[model samples]
Target chain A: MARIIGGLTSSHIPAIGNAIARNLFEDPYWKPFFDGFPPIRAWLDEKQPDVAIVIYNDHGLNFFLDKMPTFAIGAAPEYRNDDEGWGIPTLPSFAGDPRLSWHIIEQLVGEEFDVCSCQEMTVDHGFTVPMQLFWDDWQKKPIRTVPISINTVQHPIPSPARCYKFGQALGRAIASYPSDQKVVILGTGGLSHQLDGQRAGFINKPFDLMCMDKIVSDPELLARYTAHDLVREAGAQGAEFILWLAMRGALQGHVQKLHGNYHVPISNTGAGTMLLENAD
Target chain B: MSTEAITQDIPGTIIFNGEQAMKGYALNKMCYSFNKADSRAAFKRDEEAYMEQFHLNAQQKAAIRARNVLDLLAAGGNIYYLAKFAGIFGLSVQDVGAQQTGMTVEAFKAMLAKQGE
Candidate 1:
């Protein structure tokens, strides 16, 4: 049977993508952020899961204000990287595992998730930054991937409770796929940092730290936080961290928190990364 | 502002919720177009003409002209799309954030550095 081997969560800040594109790992400003990845790379090398179900939100890339899906799954064989204006360096196209994607799509529909299916979609930094940070050779020795785009950019986004439940349902689907495959899920974007308005530069370190702690131990406790509260506390953009709840919910039993890294001011974000192994 | 327009009660931060979406549809659609190099070039070549094509209101045009991040927010600018607009002026997200907070980029960087320490 297919199993979720593990899950990862991180802030997919665009600056991280810029740093990776420019090879700034040794630079002091980016050192702390880059330093966190070696251990993660080692873990992936050790586990070597067959696929990564990347859960990310589009930043005005594919779906626009015209018709935005709260939850969409990529069922394509290959997904393209989008031009998130100002022209961030483009990464190589990602290879997708359509078999696994369709399987999950069937299961999610059976569970009443009502997710949109995207046969063709281009990804933004939210999809690529985490790949660059952890799967450094993703372009060459690329792991097969499935992109699950969530709506965090537009308002009326899915609730934290709903996202968590969706993760739980996803966990069940992954566990029952009836294939001998291992999978890793990524929940990308934010710990705390607002990018707009009078509260710009907002980064509540205490709140971010609390979130990290809760994510490791009692992630469901965070469901109590309304989207309004998340905006108020974690900052506007930082509320995208709700995507982490889906990752947190996907793991079976307890998760062994393997490694975690948190750094501040990575281009208007309190960036964080964590690797969790499902306790089987 | 439309009386029926939706507004979040959050102090200081303008939440880009549904009401703001309706209010800023034209500006955002124009910003979304900035994703293409041709559109970005056209915007740079004739800023006034581009604004007119987007049918931006006086407030949005003034905000775009002044490069005021706060004014853009009040006029319903979503930051993700506006990042493109900011890039035209060589303003990083941090630079725009500093502008919104009424701090110079240096002071803002100092504030961020202090948080890490």
Candidate 2:
């Protein structure tokens, strides 16, 4: 049966995309953030997961406010990136696994977690940036991807608790798939940063640190936070922590944190990265 | 939960709830079109006409004219969509952030850099 090998988390800030495009890894402003990925990349190179389930939030590239789904999953044969009204260069298309996608979608629906399934979806920076970070040369040696976007743009987004449960459902769905395909789950975006209002550049390092630690050892504790609390503590956009929670929920057995890093002021956010392997 | 009851007094933050989404639909719909280069060019060519085509409210238009992030938020603009509107002027999040917080871009960048230290 298909099994989840591990889960990874990273901030999907748009500026990171620009930095990558400009090849600013050694630049002072980007060094710390860029430095977080090499260890995780080494692990990916070793494990070679067949597919990656990327849990990220869309930023107006796919679903808009007109038809926003609280939880949406992409089942396309390929996923592409487009301009997000910003000037970041678009990345190449990602291969998708329809068989696994439909399997998980059916299982999620069967488990009573209604999710909007899309066959044609354009992933934004929130999805693409992390893909680039983890597998910089993904186009040369691509991995099948399944993009699951949670609503972070609109309010009433899924709570940390709800996202955890959804992740648990996802874990079950992946475990049930009748294949030997290895899968990796990526919960992209946020450690704390808000980009609007007077609190536009807000970053809570202590709160982010606490949440990052708890997301590994005691995710249920992080799940206790209401969406409102996340906004208040982590900043409005920092509430993207829900994506990380979903990624954590899918690890079904003894989980070990193989590597982790935390950096601040990555384009006005406390960027975080973690690699947790599941030993079942 | 009621949007106001939940989102009240979150200093310097605006929750993009159903009410705000409904209020800003026309404005946001206009900004969303900026995703396309041609639409962005057209907006740059004649900003008012482009906004008019989307039937933006007086407040939204005024906010757009003022180029004030806070006013745009009050006009029911979500930051993600408003970003497209800001993109037309080549403004980054840090730029709009400085505008909203009344800080110089240098000071704002400094402030962000300080968080790490």
Best by TM-score: 2
lDDT of each: 0.85, 0.92
lDDT of 2 at B77: 91
Candidate 2 per-residue lDDT over residues B1-117, each given as its tens digit: 865876866988888888889998998898889899999999889989998999999999999899888988998898898898888888888898899889999999999989987
Expressed as tens digits, the lDDT of each residue in B21-93 for candidate 1 is 9988888888889888889899989999999999999999998899887888778888888887876666788
Candidate 1: misplaced stretches above 4 Å? B1-7
- Candidate 2, residue A115: CA error in Å? 0.6
Assess every candidate by TM-score.
Answer: 0.96, 0.98
Question: Which pairs in model 1 have colliding backbones?
Answer: none
What is the lDDT for A162 in model 1? 87
Candidate 2 stretches with Cα past 4 Å from truth are B1-3
Predicted candidate 1 versus true structure: per-residue lDDT over A194-259, tens digit per residue: 888787787888888888888878888997788878898888888897799888889867688899
Model 1, TM vs. native: 0.96
lDDT of 2 by residue, A140-182 (tens): 9999999999999998889999999999999999999999999
